[model samples]
Target chain A: MSVLEIKNISKSFGTLDVIKDISFSVEKGQVVSVIGPSGSGKSTLLRCATMLEKVDSGYIAYGDNIMVSNDAAGRAKYSDKATLNKIKLSTGLIFQNFNLFPHLSVLRNITEAPVCVLKKDKNEARQTALELLDKMGLSDKADSYPCQLSGGQQQRVSIARALALDPEILFFDEPTSALDPELTGEILKVIRTLAEDNMTMVIVTHEMAFARDVSDHVIFMDGGYIVEQGEPNEIINNPSSERMRTFLKRIIEK
Target chain B: MDYSELLKVTGILLQYLLPTLKIFGYTLAFSIPLGMVVAMLKMCRFKPVSWITNIYILIMRGTPLMLQIITIYYAIPMIQTGGSDFFGGLFSGFDTRSDTYQFTALLIAFVLNYAAYFAEIFRGGIEAIAKGQHEAAFTLGFTKTQTFFRIILPQVVKRVLPASSNEVITLVKDTSLANVIAYAEIFRKAKEQMVFYSSLAPLFIAGVFYFVMNAVLTVVFNFIEKKLDYYQ
Candidate 1:
């Protein structure tokens, strides 16, 4: 079963249509990577899927719970609060800059939402947070603030923060785009481990090799639309579209 | 320049310190929460609610605070004369000549005036938080209120401390503005002592009180700033 389903979604910012009637879904326990240039609206696509940006028109659902659907007027209408809250609980997002709460300890950064929003017991939340931190190789840094950690460690803690809520699906908007090449490897390795463990994810990323290696499916987007998508090996190695061919060549030469 | 006389004046001024402390303490206690409320109201998405709060902040910020004190003191009883039975009865029971009425008027004026200033400071602090923080909290299923109090407010308190400390120190000095309504705080006592002593020493002694209060405030704020230093 598809854990997330988005169909016929379009989004515009003022006069520019950032996402022009795009549609996609992430099946359960699958890793889907969205790879594209900066202006390709891949980030906007992730934003729309994660509900950070509203859709102009679309149908989005997690499992059987519909998050956004077209109303009678053919405009996008989101689900009621309870349904939205349910969808929110089932998903997590990691950002390019690792937007961790600097005011909180690394442990609190992971546990606060679960304790306060999920109403989880404090000790249980702490236990789950510590385990997630341990998995992220950040066990010793639990009491440290985000600012005190290296970029890779900060991103790891953010991942732990998302995982502590036990999201069925996670979204990454250029998770390693802000890190050094060396640091990028750590994040990619962590992501690869998540994929190996069968955690469903949709990552909007720029790292071509990492995308090909970690994703079960690769989506190449350009000019506000998905230009080509298929199995990573086929799509990355042999492209039928001229745009995809040059796009891959340009990335490779860089 | 009689040193002993200066000491005597300081002693006299010390006796009236309670009223000044009351003004400062009461204003801080009431205005801060009221300021947070006003800040929220001013930032409200509802057009009319925000519009009214904007006008309120404008009027409060635009006028002189001394004038506000005088206006509130005299204008309160005028509600009785507005000839609405319900409104008139609100102030009808209190003897307008009593010290309680004067103190109430002083508090009302101080609280409202400072609330407007604190509201602007808080608003700036709140707006300074990055958009990504809210997004992070939202994806975790935090309700808007939870996101604000838990995620946003703690960060805001850190950002606004320096600015808020400025307001708080100013509030300490501003308590003397109570004298405009004949509510005898330290500055008022100093002025009376100056006239009686026929000397400037009493007024200089009053300066010591303000200096000491602000010095203590500076230390407190620095300590708070340090406590929050665990985060960037």
Candidate 2:
């Protein structure tokens, strides 16, 4: 069964349609990478999928439940807070800016959601947070604040924070876009490990080589629509669309 | 003019200062939570609730606090019980023109006025937080209240501390305005000493007292700011 199904999803800000009739599905343990030029609405699509941006029309389903919709006025609304909470539990989001709570220590940052929101036992949340930090090779940095960590370390802690919630699918929005070239390896390594474990993920990324390497399915988007999609090898090796060819040529050359 | 007279005046001022400090303390004790409630009401998404709080804040902030004191002290009793006799009888036989009445009026006026200003400060602080933090908290499955208290309020307090400390210190000075109601606070005692002794020294001494109190408050606020230095 598909873990997430989005049908005819559309989003617009004022009158400018950022996403139009977008539809896709993710199976239980698939890694899908969305690649496109700037202004292609890839990030907006990811945000809409996560219910961060309300879609103007259509519906998002997780398992058998619809998570969002438009009312008579065409304003997007979630099904309900309770159902949104359940839907959010199944998905984790990794942001490009590494929006860690600066006031909290690394350990607290990871455990805050689990302890406060999930109502997990404090000791158990701390243990899980520490274990996730250890997985990110950041156990020693647990007591440090986000400001004390490098961009790579902070991003890794952000991932650990998401993982501490035990989400089934992770949505990464340009995870490496803000990293220095040298620092990108650490974050990519953690993502690569997750991909190897067959954790369902939908990633909007700019790293062409990383997309070509780790993605099971590659989606090319441009002008607020999916231009092309196929196996990573096919999309990278064969050009089906002239726009895709031009886009890939520019990325590959750069 | 002599040291003995100075001592007598200083001792008299000390007698009133304690009650003044008590009033200030009690007013703050009442106002902080009351202000927070007002701030919450002002921020409520519901239009009528927020609108009512907005008008309350506007009236409290827009009117002179001296008028509020007079209204609370004089007008409220006249309006409620029809005369000072009935109002005085209600207050354990204390006369409405007595020091106790003035003290109560001053306390209410200070609390209401500061509550309005603090509400505005709180509103600015709460609104200053990036919308992303709310989204982050929501996505983490935090309920709206949990997101506010755990994630949002702490950050808001950190941001508002400097401005709040300024207001708090200003509040200390503003307490001097209580003299209008005939409550014998520090400044009132100084004025009374001048009238009785024909000396300006007691007035200057009161300035010293205010300076010392504000200095102490400044130190306390600095310590608090230091504790919140995590963001830096």
Candidate 3:
């Protein structure tokens, strides 16, 4: 079964339509990269899919559990709270700003949801948290506060926090866009490792080479719709549309 | 300034510390939590709860606490009894026969008045948290209750510490106002000593008591502010 299915999703803020009739699905263990310029609805699409923002009209299903479906009257209807909670427990999202709880130490940030929300044993959660921190190359910084870490380090800790929940699918919304130019490499490398592990994931990003190297399928979005989608080599190296060509040229030239 | 007289004044003033500290302790124990509840009500989306709490806050803040003390201690009892047993019957079962009823009235006055100030401080702290924190907690599958107590309130306490400290020092001094109801806190004892001895030394010694109390609180609050300074 596909890990995620979003059908005919539409969203808007006031009069500005952010996402327009977008549909896509992520098969289990498949890596999909959403590449688009600013205001191309890449982040909005990710937000809607992750339930951060409600869609105006659509059906969203995660692993055969329908999260939201359009009713007979065409209004979005959400499932019961128990089902939604179950769905959320199986998904994780990493934000651009890192959004680490400022007052909590790094170890607490990673172990909090596991111990509190997932009801894992405290010592067991701490043990697993240490493992994830070691994977993120941040084991030494366990007790440090978020503000004490560099932007790159903080973003990596956020990734560990998301992964500590054992999510079935992960979403990254421009994870590296907020980092310094020199600091983006470490985050991209970490994401590459996750892809190597065959994690089912979707990433909205601006790094052309990183997307081409890490994703199984590439999606190019513009004006709230998919402009093109295909294997990474064909779409990244040989674009068929003028808009995709222009957008890719602008990123590749720089 | 006889040495023996000075020591005697200090000794007498120290003995009155219990009632003064009692007022401070009881009011803080009740008002801090009461203020939190009222602040939540004010912030809740219900129009009627917010409106009613607004009126309560406005009335409490708009008037002098001294007036409130007098009204609660004196006027309420009068209104409860003056219209004969028909009206006074409501307060018949009210525990007025105890010697501590007057002190309870004073406590009630302090709690209601100080709770209004604390509610605003708490509301400001609560609203100042960024929206991202709530979103992060929710997406992590935390219930609304867990999100608030675990993720939200610790940050609020950190932010509101300095303002809360100022109010706390003011409360140390505000405890003197309990003398209005003739409850005989430390200040009242000092006033009696002044009249009895025909000297202002008791009053000066009382000033020392207040200064010492305020200074001690300043140090404790500074320590707290430093402790919570681990966050931004």
Candidate 4:
């Protein structure tokens, strides 16, 4: 089943049509990566799918739930906040900036959603957080603050935080874009591990090689449009569109 | 210079300390929560609410606290009784002109003034929190209220502490304004005793009281800041 389905979604910020009538979906266990130049709206698309940014017009569904649909007035309307809470539970998001709560310790960051939102027992949450921290190789730093960690570690902790909620589909908005080149590998490795476990994910990224390596499908976007999309090997290895050909050539050379 | 005279000065200042602390405690008790409410109102999505709170903050911050205390304490009684004795007739036995009423008015003014400064400080702390924090918390399925109380408020308290510590220190000293209406707080009592007994020791004793109280508060606030220093 499609874990997430978005159709005919259109969004604009102050007359700039950042996302112009885009549509896509991610099925269960599928890994999709969206690659685009700056201002191409890949992050905006990921945000819209995750419900962080309201869609100006379209349909977005998660499993059996339709999160957003047009109202009688032809304006996009979302399910009530109560229902959104349920939809939000099924999705998790990772940002390029790592967005961890600076005031919270590493342990608290991972357990907060589980305990506060999921209403899980504190002990169980801590146990789950410990296991995730161990998985991220951050068990030793569990008591450390986000500000104290390197960019790489903070992003890993954020990934752990997202996983703690046990979302059906996780979204990454250029998760490695903010890190040093050396640190990007650490974050990408974490995402690759998730993919190996068959966790469904939609990632917006600029790291073309990482996308080709980890994603089941790769989409090339430019000027707020998906220029080409296919299996990672086919799309990255051979491109049909002139724009995709030049774009891939330029990034590969750089 | 004698021990008995020193002890005598200490006793008189100590007796007035309770009233001084009474005003300080009440002002903080009322102002802290009121300040939070006002900061929320000032930052709320509604236009009118922010506007009203903005004007209120402006007026309170713009004016001197002593002026506000005098206006509230002196002006209200005249306004209440000057009209028709309507209030006087209604509550025949009670006097709005009494020392008790003046202290009440002083408290009201102090709360209003301090709440404004605190509201600004709180607003600064809250706004300083990165937008990403809220998004992350909400994306975790935490409700807005949960995000605020659990995720946002604690961080804000940490950020606002140094600023609030200054406000708090100033509040201790500003409590002396209570004497403008002759509420007989420690400073006022010291001044009265200085003239009545023809000795300056009461003034020195009052200074000691202010210093000791402020010293205790500084240590408490520093302790709180250190506890929060676990994070950046």
Candidate 5:
């Protein structure tokens, strides 16, 4: 069963059409990687999927309900607050910058959503947050603030924060882009673990090798559209389009 | 120029010092929260609420504090009564010279003046937070109000404290402005003593009182800044 579906989605900022008629789908428990050159609208596509940016026109369905659709005037209809809240509850997004609340302790950062948004019992939220932290190997830093932790540790905390809500699908927007090479390993390792657990994930990433290693399928985007997509091996080893071959050659040369 | 006379004036000034400090305390207690409300209103996306709050802050910050005190103490009753016989009868026994009236007028003026300044400090702090913070909070399913109180307000308070402390210290000195309305604060009492004695000693004594009060406030605010040192 498809967990998410996007049909003919488009997004424009003022006069610029950042995303033009992008369509994609993710099946249950499948890890899909979106790879593209800089300025290809990969991140914007992810943001639009999560309703962080209003789409110019599209239909996005999560499960059986339509989350976004164009009205009679051809303007995308956003979900109301109640429906948006429900959509957000089921979809978690991890940002590249971590964006942890600096004033909150690590444990509080992880448990905040569960306690506040999910309305879980305090003790239950704490236990779940602790479990997530432990899974990320960050249990010892629970009492520390974001400033006290390394960038890698903070990113792990952000992932734990997202996971605490127990969303069915997670969106990672270049999760390791802001990390140092050594730090990137830690975050990628955590994500690799999630993939092993069959967690449904849609990742917009620059880590080509990690995508090739862990993703069930890979998508190559260029010029605001999908240039090529297939199984990881098929796309990496036997890309059919000359554009894909040139893009892959350029990435490999660098 | 006997030293003992100067000492007597200083002793008299001390008697009124506590009451002045009480006014400062009450003004701060009221204005901090009030300033946050004003800041929120100014930042609100709703045009009418933001416009009204902006006008209020502008008028309060633009006008003279002394005039505001005069208007509250003297002009309010005139406007209410419109110089009618009923007005005279209603307030005939009321005395503006009473301690209650004096303190109330001073308190009102101080709160209004400082609330404007504090509101600006709050706005600056809130604006300092990166746009990414709100985006992150929104993606996490936080409502606008929850995002503000939980994530944004704490960070704003942290950033605003230094500027806020500066305003607070200035407020301690601004309390002297209350003397313009005959509030009998420490400065008022000290000036009265100087008029009778025809000496600079009373003014010097008043200076000491302000210095001492400001010094104490500096220490308290420093302690507060230290508690917020987690970010540093």
Candidate 6:
């Protein structure tokens, strides 16, 4: 089953063509990792798929609900408010900087959306939040604020926050890019656990080795288009394109 | 100054304390919320609305408060002509001819003037929040209103505390400017008593009242800051 389908999507920031007619689909419980150099439109593609940015001309659907599609005039028109909201409720996005609400405690941060947005019972939400925290190994830091926690711990809390909503799909924009090399492993490990639990996810990442190890599929994007994409081992190990060879060589040298 | 004279002076000045604080309390009560409205208006995306708010802020902040108070009290009546039934009916309830009109005029000027300053401070606090906070909240399915009140406002309150305290303290001292309109607040009473007693001691006693009020404010603001320290 296709969890998300983005077809013929193109986006531009003013005159700069950031994403040019990119298309992809994520299957149920499949982890798709998008790997590319800087300014390759990977982030923009993720943003467009997540509805943070609108495509110039394309279609995006979550399950069978179309969130955005073209009109007769060729302008992108979003779904009506109620349907758009339903689509939003079904997906989650985690940022690189771990944009946790600083004024809230770890427990409140996780439970807030569940109680407020989903209208879950207060006790039920708190119980779920406690369980998520325990799973994240942050049970002891429930009362602590984001500023009080280290970067890795904050990212874990953010992941827990996303899970509390029970979204069908989670999108990550460099989940571990902002952390120290030593701290990156913990976030990757958490994502690996989710993958093992058969969670559907689309990740734009720079961790080449982790992509090869954990991702079911790898997408290589450069200059606003997918240069190549296939099974993780096939894409990462056997380079068929000149640009992919140079890109991998540069990273390996670094 | 003799001890008995000191006590007598203190007694007289204390009688005017409530009236002085009335101006401070009322101005604060009205201005804080009005300032929030003004801040939103100033930040409106519509160019004309924000431009008008900008000019209002400019006029309030550029002119002296004393001039504004005097204009509100005196110039309003002078500007109203008998044939202008519209203006006459608008201010008909407010008899600018009455001696008590000074209090109303003083309040109008103080609120408008102080609200502008508070508006600017609030605008700064709102803008200081990082863009990522809004994005994170949006991704979590929070509406714009929910994101502002639930996520942004509490943090804004903490960030604006110190600057707001400074304005509040200034308002305490600015209340003495009411003496210019002969409203007979504490400082004006102290001045009259000084002349009567042939001593400067009454003036110094007036200082005591202001200092004590500001001291209490300092303590309250400090306590609030300490409470917010747990987060930052």
Please name the candidate that would achieve the greatest DockQ relative to the true structure: 1
Summarize candidate 5's per-residue lDDT along B66-109 as a digit string, tens digits: 78887777864574467678766766554655668777767877
lDDT of 2 by residue, B93-170 (tens): 445655577777778788998899898999999999888788777677888898888888999899989988887888
For residues A1-254, write the lDDT of model 3, one tens digit per residue. 88999989899999999999888899998999999889999998988877789898989999979999999988788889889999989999989998899999999999999999999999999999999999999999999999999999999999999999999999999999899999999999899899888889999999888889899999999999999999999999999999999998888688
Model 3 alpha-carbon drift over 4 Å, by segment: A249-254, B82-93
Error of 2 at A24 (Å): 0.9
**Individual DockQ of the candidates?**
0.85, 0.56, 0.68, 0.80, 0.65, 0.80
The list of candidate 6 runs beyond 4 A from truth reads: B82-90, B97-100
For model 4, how does the per-residue alpha-carbon lDDT over B1-232 read when each residue is reduced to its tens digit?
A: 5679778878887888899899899999999999999999999999999999999999999999999998877666565666566764653444675657777788989999999999999999999999998999878988889999989999999999999999988998999988888888888988987887788888888888899989999999989999889887
Error of 6 at B123 (Å): 0.5
Single out the weakest 10-residue window by summed lDDT for candidate 6 chain A: A46-55
Candidate 3 DockQ vs. native: 0.68
Report the lDDT tens digits of candidate 4 across residue range A51-81: 8889889899999888998888767999887
- Model 4, which residues run further than 4 Å from truth? B1-6, B82-99, B197-200
Model 1 achieves a DockQ score of: 0.85
Consecutive 10-residue window with the lowest summed lDDT within model 3 chain B: B88-97
Quote the lDDT for B9 in model 5: 83
CA deviation > 4 Å runs, candidate 5: B1-4, B48-52, B71-74, B81-99
Off by over 4 Å in 2: A69-80, B47-52, B81-100
Which sequence of candidate numbers ranks them by lDDT, best first? Answer: 6, 1, 3, 4, 5, 2
Please provide, for model 1 over A1-254, each residue's C-alpha lDDT reduced to its tens digit, 9 standing for 90 to 100. 68988899999999998988788888989999998888999999988888899999989999999999999999999999899889888998999998899988999999998899889999999999999988999889989989999999999999999998899999999999899989999999899989999999999988898889889999999999988999999999998899999998999898
Predicted complex 3: CAPRI docking category: medium
Docking class of 1: high
TM-score of model number 6: 0.97
**iRMSD (1 decimal) for each model:** 0.7, 1.2, 0.9, 0.9, 1.2, 0.8
